[model samples]
Target: MKEIRFENVCKSYGKTEVVKNLNLTIKEGERLILLGPSGCGKSTTLRMIAGLEDITSGSLYMGDKRVNELPSGKRNVGMVFQNYALYPHMNVIQNITYGLKVQKFPKDEINLRTDAALGMLQLKGYENRLPKDLSGGQRQRVALARAVVKQSDYFLLDEPLSNLDAQLRVSARKELVKIHELYKQTFVYVTHDQVEAMTVGDRIALMYQGHLQMVDTPENVYNRPANIFTAKFIGSPPMNVIDMAFDNSNDSAYLAGQEIPLQEEWRNYIRQTGVKELAFGIRPEHITLSKTQLKNGLKGFVKYVENHGSSYGVYIDLEGNEIIAMSESNKWPPKEAIYVEPRLDKMHVFDKQTTNSIGYPTSIR
Candidate 1:
């Protein structure tokens, strides 16, 4: 395995820059994911690392060696694409050993490596089966097996599970994790699925509009997002960001007509930054519903409810704004009137103008 580094890397098509100046480092044997929506330049970044695209500026490194000029075949990287990309007439064994055959390895060595890959991927008895004969999940395993048999220093996976059904994707995720654990190789995966990035990656790089937003573990990104774009993009159903104005006329700040007690450090930060407008944010799971209003909260009407089998989502209208909360209990509040109090410690505060988190300091857990 090798450490991968990108220093101020960029890509452009004619005059429009697809990937802006980006810098990142992926540790050896680490599982890193690039996550964002379409046109966010994630795939372009992956292609650059795989030597399939030219870097418009900056440098790329594998460990200490600068590889910005290396060709794809000479980079010693294995890539698995969204489509299987298998030869139509080739069977599993042929597909797995094709690289070795082209390299002119001994026939016995080819058999040995192919057999090991087949066994590792749980394709032990399907060597002769053609690609058309295999299921989607099985074909995916074959793709992985081929990458494994190549003995590459790094693995690049670009939406490898997007072609599979939901159930198969779930199962395949576990399998991919196991394969990473067994092989102990540096893996860089790209996908738009936040769930996949959260569950699969050791560290995630969140991007938007060709810019790198933040890079951290799943828990850190979810609990203490660096900016508003991350908090709005990383979670399902998203975080509730209520518009609020900080009243600086008094000695302390007030949010929604309620006094906000700032931590000693945060008070200093606000004073230094000269922040005036703030947004109060919280996740759905951190809210509790009641029939009466609390001293520091709001009373709202339940607009609708969604039953997701494991839990219920109660959407409420607070004043004129909408907020959604997740409930563990099957019993729900009345649809007409209800109150919600967000757990104070679980709340987030962001600059209303810049949209960057400013409430609490966090460390990776």
Candidate 2:
């Protein structure tokens, strides 16, 4: 069952729309990541689900019940804020049980839930420590425990690991998945971090400029992006998008005035689309930098190279456009003339006017 759903839901602050007409669904026990850059309304969308933000128009349903007018307390969702939202004066034990105390849950039940949460989150011996005294990871655990104690069917977290250092964030992510496994809930995580979204989310709902860009699994979001925004957003160096035009023949396309051959399936697809002006996209890792010209290679000069520790990024100047190609070795120096050949099967062609990818080869269907 779809545990949460939005139908044309929109939220605006007076004249400015914060969330545009949104149509999305969160499944019963799936972890859905609401991913986008800051001010893209991912947090606002999460707030709307928790009933903290009012839906200016349309319907929001939680398990067949319209929750547009529901109060925050009545919605019964457990949320962890970006700041962790732990009470400064309260100790870990008190902070985790405070919600249940307010709700008047029986003393014995509250103790049982608190014990379970504390043990699961590994805070058994540190219950006496106040939020101010705990480490960042410990504090985050306390905040998570507070939510876990509620045992709500819906779990929400907004940039929960953004405050931690790189290594701590990695460990926290694992804990979150572990928590979800112990008690399966409809998890909605909001983050600007693509790494977090790709790692923890069962599916990612990518948004941009208050619009739902695409909703797909991490693999599809990375490999088969719906539009230019998603193609550029999900990757580290991002996809290399170069201006291309269909040549007189369907078997080839022109990139930087060089005719590059297309695979038979891509040729057929582009020919079927009949769009002359095109934006060709390929991931950096899919591109190979060669010292000598190869078949279907575009000639370019090496602008510079960047060491990524594990891999090297070779920036090549294709006419006036700069494209990055990932290499295992950095043999080419500055100003070296080289060729870049994109994997034919990995190429993505988008309609220049609409900025939408022409669907993959029919064989991919």
Top candidate, metric TM-score: 2
All models: lDDT? 0.84, 0.92
Q: Candidate 1, residues 257-282: lDDT per residue as tens digits?
A: 54656555555555666777778788
Cα deviation at 201, candidate 2, in Å, is 0.7
Which RMSD does model 1 reach against the true structure? 2.4
Clashes of 2: 0
lDDT of 2 by residue, 1-365 (tens): 53999999998999999899999989999999999998999999999999988899999999889999999999889999999989999999999999999999999999999998888888989989999999998999999999999999899999999999999999899999999998899999999999999999999999988999999999999999998899999999999998997865436678888988777777877888788778999999999779998887889999999999999999999999899999999798999999999987888888888898888987753
Model 1 stretches with alpha carbons more than 4 Å out: 251-272, 329-335, 359-365
- Model 1: lDDT to the true structure: 0.84
TM-scores for candidates 1 onward, in order? 0.92, 0.98
Task: Kindly give the stretch of ten consecutive residues in candidate 1 with the minimal lDDT sum.
Answer: 356-365
